[model samples]
Target: MKLVRYGAPGAERPGVLDAQGRVRDLSMLLAEMGPAQMSPRTLAALATIDVERLPLADAGVRLGCPLGGVGKIVCVGLNYRDHAQEAGMAVPAEPVLFMKAVTALSGPYDDVQIPPGAQKVDWEVELGIVIGTRLKHVKKEDALGHVAGYVLANDVSERAYQTERGGQWDKGKSYDSFAPVGPWLVTADEVGDPHALDLWLDVNGQRMQDGNTRDFIFDVPTVLSYISGFMTLEPGDLVLTGTPAGVGLGQKPQPRFLRAGDEMRLGAAGLGEQCLKCVQS
Candidate 1:
């Protein structure tokens, strides 16, 4: 089932997509699609609801981040071999982890504001994992069982702040609108094989990044398990499992960056799509 949140930004209501590709209100059933509703049991229960009977949302309603009350947004850097090669970095033995401030979260199609004086703004299309259960030091074999769902994400970055003026990558990664995720929170059962999905991103109608999750140097389970060992993985925690090559910083001849009015379109097969406009703050 495709889970969603619809309506205005803060007042968005929980919804599920019906077979006709229409929004079906889940407001009467779930107050918010937050941590409490992310567990395997909760999701299983939700799956049993007859979406056809639920109230249909207004046509063309705005979609907000699919899951609410999200915890820390953890990201794996250079987890894709191609991305590592393009960036002139070697693949690490362990997952490279970083934090993206939760405040950076925005709707999939929302306008992404370019922070003042920022240059080198870039895009990274990646598979996002949503934790469903509390986990600590989980084994890789068991890690996937704790996942609630999957969503596509764009890890927008400012290279100057990230590599030049930064102590940690968070300085460049944590800007508001930097992490636009979800058109739907596809259930784990529906996704089936997260590592095999094809993902791509385009800037202003030009295809820039085109890659598959199968190229991930450290796959989802490994990244999740590794993260759980260092810090507890709680429900609703989002993990961006890295992007394949073709980011603006890795462009041929010269690097390209986002300017006001630039548009971005990206998606992962089955996870849905995101279309964003870059705007000056």
Candidate 2:
């Protein structure tokens, strides 16, 4: 099922997509899509609703981050061999984990803010995993059972703040609107094989990154189980499984970066696309 949240930024209401790709309001049946509703049982119940009967949303309504009250965003970096090589870094022995503040969460099509004096802004098209149940110290074999769904994400970053700031990558990654999530969350059952999806990103209509999940050095279950060992992952918590090569910093003729007014269009198979504009703060 394709689950969504549409309306103004903070007032978005829960919804589901109908056969024609129209928004069918679920507000009457569900107050909001949050941690509790992400559980397998609740999602199963939601799947039984007759989408054709729900009221359609107003035409062209703004979409908000699909899930409300997101707990935290855990990200894995350098999990792709090509991306690590492009950045001149070694492929890690284990998942290279990082945190993107929940505050960075934004709608899939929202404008990404470029902070003052920031230069070297970049884009990363990645597969985002949404946790459905509490998981702690779970083995890799059982990790898939805790996932609710997946979403496409653009992990907008500022290369300078991330590398030259003399601090953790979170400094450049936690900016507002840096984590534009979904047009909708495609349930686990619908996604089929999480590691076989194709992913791509374009800037101003020019293709910048074109890759596939088949190249992942460490797959989904490994990432989830590895993370759960240290930090408890709860429903509504998001995990960005990292991006493949072709980021701005990896451009051949020096590096290309985002300037105000640049538009980024990106997506993954099964997960819908995202169109975000870069704007100055």
Candidate 3:
């Protein structure tokens, strides 16, 4: 089941993507795709609805971040060993967690805003986990049970603000339009094994990041459970599982960065794709 939210930015209506790739409105049944709609119980109830009877949305409309009322966007850095190596950083003993301001959330195909004086803007294509229930100190075995679904995300960053600034990674990562998520919030069942999926990112139609989740140093379950041990995982919260090794910063002697009018295309198996146009804000 591919859950969706469509319409203009601030006035989205809940919907779902049918098997043949049509959008079926769910707004009549569920007013909004928020914490209530994101819960496991609500999802189960939603599955019982006959999609064919639902109104067909127009051919092409703006898709908002699948889930609304998102509380926070958590991220695990260097979860992929190769990514850590490419960044010339040591493999962390545990997941290196960070928070992305929820305001950064944007529609999948939206243009990524380049902040003023942004010199080292970069991109990190990552798999985003959506929490279904509140969890705290949960065991590793129960981690998957708490996940609502997965969404494709571009963890856009500004290297200078992330490193050069004498502060945390928040400024570099939490800019508005920094996190463009979702073509769909694919249900866990449809996604099958998140561990073996093929995920990649292309810059201006050229492939730059290509890797599988199998190489993750600390897989999804561990990362989630590890996080739950310290912070409360609330429904509608998103967790980004980190990117592979091919980020622009990982390039040879001279690293490349995003420029105005540059395009970024990325996707993962089962999950849908995302296309972002970079622009100066």
Candidate 4:
């Protein structure tokens, strides 16, 4: 089922998209789609709910990030060969891991904030994996068993703070409204082949990123297992697999960075789209 959260920013209520594509309220059944609801058992129980009988939401309610109680936002850098080549870097033998602060999380359609003093804001369209159970030191063959579902994610970045500064990449990545994640949280059972989906991103109606997940140097299972080797993966922890080619930074001659008033729309096959406008902070 395509689970979601709808309504105003902070007051969003749990909901699901019915067969007719209408948003049906699920608040009476679940508190919210959070860490607890992300587990396999919880999802199985939620499946027993009869969406047809649920009350339909009003016509004009806004949509929020599909899940709540998000923990760490871990990201893999340059995991795509083409993206790595465009950035003038070599494809690493292993996944390059980094974390985006949870505060960066925002509703899918919310405006993206171009933080003060940031000049090189850019966009990255990626596939985000949501963990359902605790995992540590798991083998690659078993890594996928720990995932609950997938969602569309925009890994917004400020290149100057990321590379120019002598610190970790998190500095440029963890700004407020940087991670716009979801229109829906599609369960793993529905997304049969995670690596075959197409993903794209547009800035102000111009397509900047267009690629597929098949290009990922490190696939989902590999990435999950690799990270588990070092740290414990918990429920609600998100892993942004990586971005495809065609980012603004890969443009010829000079890079095109995001500016105030710019709009972005990104999505994956079956996962749904996120539309956001960039505004000065």
Candidates in order have lDDT scores of 0.94, 0.94, 0.91, 0.91
Candidate 4 matches the true fold with a TM-score of 0.98
lDDT by residue for model 4 (233-266), tens: 8998999999988888888989999999999999
Against the hidden reference, what TM-scores do the models get? 0.99, 0.99, 0.99, 0.98
Q: Which ten residues in a row have the lowest lDDT in candidate 1?
A: 85-94
Off by over 4 Å in 1: none
- TM-score of predicted model 1? 0.99
The digit string of per-residue lDDT tens for model 1 on 126-155 reads 999999999899999999999999998999
The true-versus-predicted C-alpha distance at residue 254 of model 4, in Å, is 0.5
Model 3: per-residue Cα lDDT at residue 120: 93
Q: Which whole-number lDDT from 0 to 100 does residue 111 have in model 2?
A: 94
Candidate 4: misplaced stretches above 4 Å?
none
lDDT of 3: 0.91
TM-score of 3: 0.99
